[model samples]
Target: MTAKLIHGYEVVIGFETHTQLATQSKIFSRAATAFGAEPNTQACAVDLALPGTLPVMNREAVACAIKLGLALGSHIAPVSIFARKNYFYPDLPKGYQISQFEIPVVQGGEVSFFLGDEKKTVRLVRAHLEEDAGKSLHEDFIGQSGIDLNRAGTPLLEIVTEPDIRSSEEAVAYAKELHKIVTWIGICDGNMQEGSFRCDANVSVRKPGQPLGTRREIKNLNSFKFMQQAIDYEIRWQIEQIEDGHAIQQATVLFDPDTGETRAMRTKEDAADYRYFPDPDLPPLHISEQWVQEERAQMAELPRTMAARFVADYGLPEYDATTLTQSKAMAAYFEAAAKACGQAKLASNWIMGEVSRRLNMAETGIEQAPVTAAQLATLIGRIADGTISNNAAKQVFDALWTGESNDVDAVIESKGLKQMNDSGALEKIIDEVIAANPDNVAQFRAGKDKAFNALVGQIMKASKGKANPTQVNELLRAKLAG
Candidate 1:
């Protein structure tokens, strides 16, 4: 919808992002929470909801929640309590989820992110600590359903944002920015495919200055593309209902990727309806101020700050800076290459262009990069030292990828790929080219720049494309002009 129509009908979005903590054990038990395990094998007494098995809080999970709160500029609650969210599902063995209700571990935070050209900030309502539910696999071939408890009891930090988002674009941007932060901070892997991190977008459309419309929550939007699509479709659907003089109902919906639409799962349930009550087995969590301070001190530079530094310190364009700072690994690679080659722009070009292109083609990520920063820096140094032509340097990079060698000098020498920088040798090649292309030489004398270019091409070909281009140009100009 156009902004004007959207202005008449505000698009309000709130995000409930579940980020699985990077811990070795389950939140309330000693059972391993590792992914890809056999179904139901990871479940222990606590995870299986066996009676008389009390819950024990994991200190590491609480620490992770605090770290995330500090990163989001949120206040760490001095005391937070865990309550049982009662529900019945085949996947949920406990018949209730142990989660924070009115008292969250982190409260009143703000996450700053950008939306296109405009800088948008979203207020965080709270980030609560919770344990994840299990997964159900249904297939017709099996003719029966299966349950996987490997994901059950995994510690998750549920970050909730206020209804400040105005469009699907903003919602997607917020999710992406959050993903970057959590991944960079080493708190979560942010692998949407593996369900390490996921988002549910709550969408509602209202007339400007009117009371907010009844919101629909779209769940299980794991990927960023799906998040955008699901929210976009939900917003339109709500607007259609309002236009038809029907009031929108608050409900939980699921996005169908095959149909590109959201279908209602059930009516939204309020927390009181879940019969929230403190678990008598577990004690309330008390986060000391010193602990929060320590985590804040350990945080590495965030993406936005790092991107600005790339612009200010390295003199990179905004786009280049953004590209380089997208991931911690890419930024580290650029920094090492820049330090070695002593050329920030050139280092950025190689990393963003050739390195990025190759990684995308191979379906690899920066973490799985074949070329290390030191190797890339060394290769770029060869070009700077005039040891290899730019085209030849690319060949060296390819060789480096195949376990050949990263030593630029060694590769050039072993392959006999060094540029012919000797003026006399270039002059002889230019002489041979002039002797063969008398017509082109005459054309150059007639002030035809194109003819001189053609002659240069022949000289480069005669040298097997190893001639220094600058030397070829100078020698060609002198010989042909004479």
Candidate 2:
């Protein structure tokens, strides 16, 4: 495949995401990891890295890492090492962060998703276990900054992706897919607003066939919209800089959503700059094969596997299956409706088209939809059994969605939406339509398909759109032939 070029330069992007694990306690301490706590209230001795405090690994945090490995089809290492990432910040009361450096818990996985109609896969470099540093509160301090240690020592799985992403759209899609996997597996809460899931995008641009360009890291992109905007602005900024004879420098940048631009924060650091050394406090972490097996046994049916099953069993298109299984609620709703109605394709179409449109317009999720799966199933069944036309089904759906009626049959009956299925009655309407439009009859007999469609439309209109379309077409053809 040819690389997509932007203004004669190829854009390359990589992601380093910090996914906060859902564990209640800190990674090395018993301090609470809950959000929105008072400053310094949740910091314990181990979290603060006080003298005589030895770091003890949290068992639940390791279990969460194991679950993430299972979800992503990554290699869960039997043994991993912890290192101290030395840094200076007022928020880092420990003066150094305990993180995995040499060997990570999860390694070598690929996340696949559809970009438009094309499927794209992003390769994972590693997901290392790390502890979050405390947050620095700069606002409302009257020129003095306050540190919030409540978030200190929060367990984090820093997932690193390869530089396979070439566009902002693909980057956002990859982030969202990763978010879904982490949240679906119950390893992370996946909240971007509360800083549960944060992303750092390394963006660069180079001329086609040239070596990779210098990358500047965009730190702490908490929202997908800001992520794309930041990458795009950064890409353009780099391209313009190179064109004007300014060399692109490696630095950490921050995205200011208010101004829709990226500004340099600090020089990007390399591995040696951090002076990584194995932590003496914590010993080498070991995981038995039995533990991985236990985690696999407890895993739920993943979206990818479920989508393949849908394609095989339900005879749905790959796109339909993938879209339907985007979330557990959506997948369950689709499966229930498809099974109940025995019209998998119809159920998929309605859910993807009308149902999704309504949900997006309302800025809500499938779990909060007004129409129940059973109700939608009954409506689809009515359409399949020729009890109502497609147009009538839309009307019934609107009533159900708007809470105008709870019962499917009640809405259909109340709105007089029953299809005119009687062969004799439809034949009468077809004969009248044929006689009333002699020209259309001549044209359809002369092989004008549009004329046939026009005649069907006339018959449906004559029946007040209540005619069974199949019956009308058959009777219309027979009358025209005779």
Candidate 3:
């Protein structure tokens, strides 16, 4: 229903997210899981399900899953069982996927996220460790499609949340929080474009006191914008069907980006249909308490904790802290720059404005930044200490991107871009500006405040745009008022 409809119907949402572990090798095989490789180039005999091939679990993938569980404040199971989910598809060479069925590695967690002024918590049902299936590419240029087994057997952490969401906004907030957690905990890279992270939303609408409506699963929504849109469309479609006296069907749906609509791909399959059973080829996953403790100790400060610290220590607002701590690399960059400049607010402003702008333009991340945190700190320091005017600092920052010197002091000195901070020298320029602009002085004396700004502009021009702006403004106002 739209926001205008107040029929007392509530929308419930749950999410199942698959986050590919940031490991070099696949979970069940030694095949490389790198993206953009030629089709089937990175596959191994085990990944291809060749005869006499046995699967061995990757230790790093398990550790990464535990790290995520700790970050979510979840209970880590000492032992979890893996089962074979039998399905027949071209991409599934073995006709079954190794996944968690009855006992998962992590369970009963909660994630707190902010929605505007209110902080909401979503309970996580379970986080299971699983292996990803291969991709089925359909290209008309080749007259058919082929399988890319590079993604096959890749380790994936499937995080499932309880149906605590009451609206589309809450669903988006939960997804964003999960994305941040995975990236902050160093488990997943959180690159939606590369398919490293993906979300599937389960949505249903019901009356306030009625039984829950049948839900539909929307699959493979990668971006946050698309996630919100897909949920909204699904909810509206379900509501309309119920109102029109039609029953909601339980099925799997795919979102069409071009039309911004959802279409049913197939009826949702049940666990019994998948024929889930223990795989004889692989042993049960045994996670000891010691292993869990060690991984927890290695867990970095999570985004929420880092955000709180940024607010407490750096005196930043909650919004600013949230933006700064969106990614671990971003938080590190902010902290390093803040330390070097000794002015946290100034560092934040420059990083959020100029640095973020450049990163967005280039479509890159903070880790792949052209300028380092130290370099940005030094540049802001020069501006703060009056070694370079704010305008000149932008120029210096642009020049620093060419892989030359990033030292603001060196750049200013080499380029002769230092600000003119001498008040006595600026006073002479202000006097000349007032004398030349007699009409403006007359207007100022007549109580027109805008006349003084013109005089300030003249002083700035006379200084060749190198005068300290605050010093220039003060001298011009004093001379004009006299």
CA lDDT of each prediction against the hidden true structure: 0.87, 0.93, 0.87
lDDT per residue for candidate 3 within 1-482, as digits (tens), equals 23223245688788899999999999988888888998889889998889999999999999998888888889998888999999999998788999999999999899887787677889999999999999998999878988888888999999999988888888889899888888878888899989999999999888876777788999999999998898888888888888899988899999987888999999999889999998898787899989988987877788878999999999998878887887878999999999988989988998888989999998898899888889888888888888888789888888887767767677788888988988788778888888799999999999998987888888788899988988887777776666
Question: lDDT for model 2, on a 0 to 1 scale?
Answer: 0.93
User: Which 10 residues in a row give candidate 1 its minimum summed lDDT?
Assistant: 1-10
TM-score of each: 0.78, 0.98, 0.77
Report clashes for each candidate as comma-separated counts: 0, 0, 0
Candidate 2 on 132-219: residue-level lDDT in tens? 9989888765777788888889999999999999999999999999998888888888899999999999999999989999999999
- The CA lDDT at 313 in model 3 is 97
As a TM-score, model 1 comes out at 0.78
Clashing pairs in 2: none
lDDT of 1 by residue, 1-482 (tens): 33434525888889999999999999999999778887888989899879888889999999899888877878899999999999898889999999999899989888766565466788999999999999999888969988887788999999999998888898888898889889988889998999999899889888877887789999979998889899888988888888888988889999999999999999999877899999877889999999888887888987777888999999998778877877898899899889888888989999989999999999998778788888888888888877788899889999888769867678888999999988888888888899999999888899889998999899889999989998788877876656
Candidates sorted on TM-score, descending? 2, 1, 3
TM-score of predicted structure 2:
0.98
Rate residue 196 of model 3 by lDDT: 94
Off by over 4 Å in 3: 1-12, 23-58, 84-96, 111-121, 134-153, 164-177, 189-194, 205-213, 223-229, 232-236, 239-245, 270-285, 402-418, 428-467, 472-482
Cα deviation of 9 in candidate 3 (Å)? 7.4
Of the candidates shown, which would achieve the greatest TM-score relative to the real structure?
2
